[model samples]
Target chain A: MSEEKRTDLESLGEFGTIDLLTKNFLITRESTAFGIGDDAAVLERNEEQYTLVSTDMLVEGVHFNLMYVPFKHLGYKSVAVNVSDIAAMNGTPEQITVSIAVSNRFPLEALEELYDGIRLACQHYKVDLVGGDTTSSRSGLVISVTAIGVVDKSKVVYRSGAGTNDLLVVSGDLGAAYVGLQVLEREKSVFQANPDIQPDLDGKDYIIQRQLKPEARMDVIAYLKELEVVPTSMIDVSDGLASEILHLCKSSKKGAMVYNAKLPIDSLTSTTALDFNLDPVTCVLNGGEDYELLFTVSQNDFDKIKGNPHMTIIGYMTDASDGIYLVDKNESLIPLSAQGWDHFQQ
Target chain B: MSEEKRTDLESLGEFGTIDLLTKNFLITRESTAFGIGDDAAVLERNEEQYTLVSTDMLVEGVHFNLMYVPFKHLGYKSVAVNVSDIAAMNGTPEQITVSIAVSNRFPLEALEELYDGIRLACQHYKVDLVGGDTTSSRSGLVISVTAIGVVDKSKVVYRSGAGTNDLLVVSGDLGAAYVGLQVLEREKSVFQANPDIQPDLDGKDYIIQRQLKPEARMDVIAYLKELEVVPTSMIDVSDGLASEILHLCKSSKKGAMVYNAKLPIDSLTSTTALDFNLDPVTCVLNGGEDYELLFTVSQNDFDKIKGNPHMTIIGYMTDASDGIYLVDKNESLIPLSAQGWDHFQQ
Candidate 1:
């Protein structure tokens, strides 16, 4: 037999594989304003409006485990994460289509509960549930959602628009979701070891909620619009602060410096990290699924966002040669590395 | 323990479940022109055009078996099916987002080959590959594609617009894909029983291609536009001719009469059906995944479609009281029953 070259997928990773595959795309439609390199694709739907489109997939064992996660929350999260992509574009999500593949092990009532969560999320986000396909599966359940949103042509923001010296801002705190995951893992282990043990989740409500029912920060986007501030570049913090910041930097051809002292970490998140014997700062930087907005604004708009309670200016963009780094509380500079989740990695 | 109420999904079936779940959707957006009832959802993008969106999911082992299906063909089929939905709406497909969940057992080259087919489909359809998510799965593979299309507000056709006496027309022949699937399944069994036996597949190219790489009828759509004939109602024939006609009838509150002699069946499909001891007429009526266009044109436009080599006028719409029926060569009327695919049914 002739030896054919076979490369493992783990070596290329998710981001690398996507970049490789999409580099050959030829845009053929005049309405396609932007394609394949952002949180969402932008299409020129009219003279005044640009539409944003994005999709996300959640697999049973890869993205969630039903043993600890309720089906309703899984349904809500599938919608929320896709809505987050629209929020990252500074656009208001208007419609979504959800497709699912389920095994027969799930009953009709289980799906009803899941759709209840989806209905609640649609109501909360004010997005219409437009169309989708449902089919049976051989393995576990899979859910894929595609969201569409619209923004005025002038208000659309992209990750590539950030310029050097722009101020970096973030909405809400980070790391709580990761801490909550750790807590859930611990409880699962305890239950597996002894069925009599009840989960000790009394004081961990904040972190646990962060993990299970994360919200897309549409309120922050509305607040920014109310304050008359349009960010130069924006992205949702789904893959941790460090990875998202790097994404903005790579696309904008700039670097960033995040001060350690300014990184927002909730008290519950910090306490949970300590309990897990993990560094709280590491958790804040690399913990994922926060669903916050990480954005860069022109230095001129600093005053508008400076004192906003929902937002904090964490850092500033720098020349590309300077590289991405974290300035510690002791005024020491350390280079940042992406420790975000990569599902392709073993 | 007190007994809790539960319903089986199989009892409701796929269509019944979707209707039950989506019945309560409150469409708050003025831009939402159509939701959840047609081939694709329609949204008013501007004053001049309506945007169409649709999604479909294919699960491994459930939708296609890898033993007989090539990865590239699978990817091509996945994109083609979604594109067909836009064509069903009489819209020009503009862009698509393809989300995939794959197990790591697949090498990087497998995905590269799959993307090659996806890229080719995009080129052939003149649609842009916009954006999507890629992640790992515990299951074999799951592909979900969302296609976006556009049509002039005045020209968009819906499933609910058919009237009594409209002429029923279909593009190309039926039952070829199902015959192709049977060929592949037979070849698979032969190969499984003997290691050294080379299965014969010569002269079966048409049927095999129909199964592995079905094309969406965008050409027919374009041709109809050139003829200045807009179908009163349209739906792509994915779930067999009988089922699609039933969907149109149910949606339009009408009935239809199909003639057995007028039903277009390819020679290879008929011969293969005979070889498999299956009725050729049943194959044409109940076999799915043809990806042909089934539409209704006004009686006044009957002269426009009479002699088109690419189309066949097989039937006509009738009042709801007449019921859907098939007329045999002997002029005997038989009630048409939908025996099309139901993935949820065992």
Candidate 2:
């Protein structure tokens, strides 16, 4: 490192860093149908089925602050996020491996509480807790969860499958998790200033729940199966709408045209964003950790999804020659920029 | 945690912690051929094969030290150790997901060096690097690797398959990795006190390599296939020979009797143990991180493995009432104790 050119991780960004490090890791196994560039890696289990695999790691202080985050909530969020990754692939998760590295400072009871949340998530998802590794860390806590799922080979979707003219749809409202985080941060600062002052998060239950216990949209996946509609391409909104949409565009070699006013935002999210003196539109575009499913379907299937409470068509795919852009409220076109959560920033 | 029963993690130990936490995780999936209590979790992929899954977490300070250990070796060892788990199950690893949580203090160049080793190991094993998550940490680096493998249902081995009178066999020699660690630790201290002084590790290359980069016993697995010998029960020798033998005994509900005379000990390992004023027998019994395969084979398959350069028959399984014991050089019986690596100690 001393003699080589040193590059700061923050400047490279999280996805950029992953791309740089794994560029040479060519997939040689025939079973590996897809690797690296999607919500989940797909492997052909047999001629008829494909196994979907995805892993996510949550680090204390970087992902969540224990001072405001309960261990139970943290555990549930960790599993839910990984489950969302599987859901992004339009697959049903059947098993997961949860590995945790905790500091000695954490008592056994603390871990039990965390496991309680994990157990609840596993039960809710109906996925077996198959295997895991537990070891002590020198500092803080680290939880890494890998989810395994299956999908029919004919029904499998990929990020590179979207075509021009496909209608873009989202499963849930955006920006609530980011706004909930703002509320928590503000309340923490207020408590620090005056320990006796109680938190005033009385009627903000929706946003709080959205942030603390976000659910993977397995219900939407089930609904899609019931409707007999398969998305050409899909991704989860873990890194906000803007970033995820751009990823889909990059992988599919297409462009997207998103109508800013058509974005689904919770009323509370908009109100909270205004209260924090931030633009609500910006929050909806860039707010992360929503865990919502974003997908593109053929125009022929648009009527089937029309008027569905769970579905919202916000945009349409465009030819690669057209740049990814957003039509703002003022009817002005602006190019989209990805401002996803970058954990490497100091 | 304060008012309730605050049990310490050390009292629970690593294995105990995993058992207690996952005890309520009911495996409702029909695909789960086996869950927990083995080198890897097994899933029935089809009538012909079972999918083997295992995960391991490596944390800096607890599992390794960057002061002396190179990141490249650490990367290779991490993947190699996880692959050993699959090998212990008599499976061929096909894919792996590696998640690393690193602090922002790390340079992009350092991560590149680590990935270089990871890429090398993947190439050597011919396994696809499917997918993983990378995130920033507040402290030292944490790596979690999950390996997926496949074994024919007829050839699959588990830690619970051994029966009374089965012979215990181990691949390769023991105590070398522990002695090598001692050498590196001594060199580190010497370098700390006098940075200008060169390290005196010229002839200790064999043992040092064993400590820094232990290979998984996949070769032994291939050899066993060639000999058409399926072990009754098997496990990887990561937590010392004594501990691994006890694990197989417990899982199989049998007792084992190992003779000190039959244990394979390298000449360099014995010479280094004496240099450190440690008992060579004790080191062979209690030193961990060998990454060798320990298995129990039926008496009928003895001829297939006998005289094999990679394997040594060290012991035999016995009735549960016989109790696990070690036969000393003096011909005295002593109870076996498992002093495996427990990372929860303060």
RMSD per prediction, one decimal? 1.4, 1.0
Give all TM-scores, in the order shown: 0.99, 0.99
List model 2's recovered fraction of native interface contacts, to 2 decimals. Answer: 0.84
The whole-model C-alpha lDDT of candidate 2 against the native structure comes to 0.91
Q: Residue A290 error for model 2, in Å? A: 0.2
- DockQ of every candidate: 0.70, 0.82
Q: What are the lDDT figures for the candidates, one per model?
A: 0.92, 0.91
Query: Which segments of candidate 2 are over 4 A away from where they belong?
Result: none
Best by DockQ: 2
**Which pairs clash in model 1?**
none
Please, what are the lDDT tens digits per residue for candidate 1 over residues B214-263? 99999999999999999999999998899999999999999999999999
lDDT of 2 by residue, B1-346 (tens): 3456788898889989999998988999988889877889998786698888999999999889998788899989989999999999999999999999998888998899888889999988888898898899999999999999999999999999999999999999998999899999999999999999888998899889999999998999999999989999999999889999999999999999999999999999999999999898888788989899999999999889889999999989999899999998898999999886777753
